[model samples]
Target: MRELIVTNEPVLISYAEALLKDQRIEAMVFDRNMSLMEGSIGAFPRRLVVSDDEWAEAAQILRDAGLGEWVVGNARK
Candidate 1:
């Protein structure tokens, strides 16, 4: 698995996951708790996680959906 998307916004996280799922790419969200923490105070950019294997695929899935660009393997360069 790999990280498909990372955002403080829950809607973006859920949207990306659903979009990637349509492509058969496994997607997950992490740092969700950080949102609660931030909401209590004030912050942003909470880290999200996905399986390592799905990194490239998930990133591409998001990209294709016009979500945003992400680093993946050679794309990291």
Candidate 2:
């Protein structure tokens, strides 16, 4: 699992999660408690997850859906 961003906003998180879900890409968000904590540059909501064995396909799905900005590390084909 890897973190792609740190946002305390629920709406954004939900949007991303739903998009991933519709594509049959299983994912999980962590640092939910950080939402309540004051994000002081470091403390922030972390969405932690991987694309299973279907990462390549999922990456394209995400790109087509306008989430290409979130791809982390070398998500190679």
Candidate 3:
């Protein structure tokens, strides 16, 4: 899997996940439990990831949704 976005905002992650799901791309948020365990202090930022094979398409989907700023820089290939 590859990392797509890393953020402390759960709402953003949820929105991104929904967008991906609408396109049939499965996304997983990592470190969510860790972040909660850390008291949601924004310390352990959560990561949204998709399978390596779906990274490019998922990134493009997010970018086209006006969330390009949140997409990871090294998303290519």
The number of the candidate with the highest lDDT is: 3
For each candidate, what is the lDDT? 0.60, 0.63, 0.91
lDDT tens per residue, model 2, 37-67: 7644545656646545666665666667676
TM-score (all chains, Cα) for each model: 0.65, 0.62, 0.90
Error of 3 at 39 (Å): 2.0
Better lDDT candidate (2, 3): 3
Prediction 2 TM-score vs. true: 0.62
Q: Note the clash tally of each candidate.
A: 5, 0, 0
TM-score of 1: 0.65
Clashing pairs in 2: none
lDDT of 1: 0.60
Can you give the lDDT of residue 32 in candidate 1?
67
Q: What is residue 10's positional error in candidate 1, in angstroms?
A: 1.8
Tens-place lDDT per residue, model 3, 1-77, is 99999998889999999999999999999998995577767888899999999999999999889898899894544
Cα lDDT tens digits, model 1, 1-77, are 45455455667777776776787765555666675766645266544456777676666666667765533342531
RMSD of each: 3.2, 3.4, 1.9
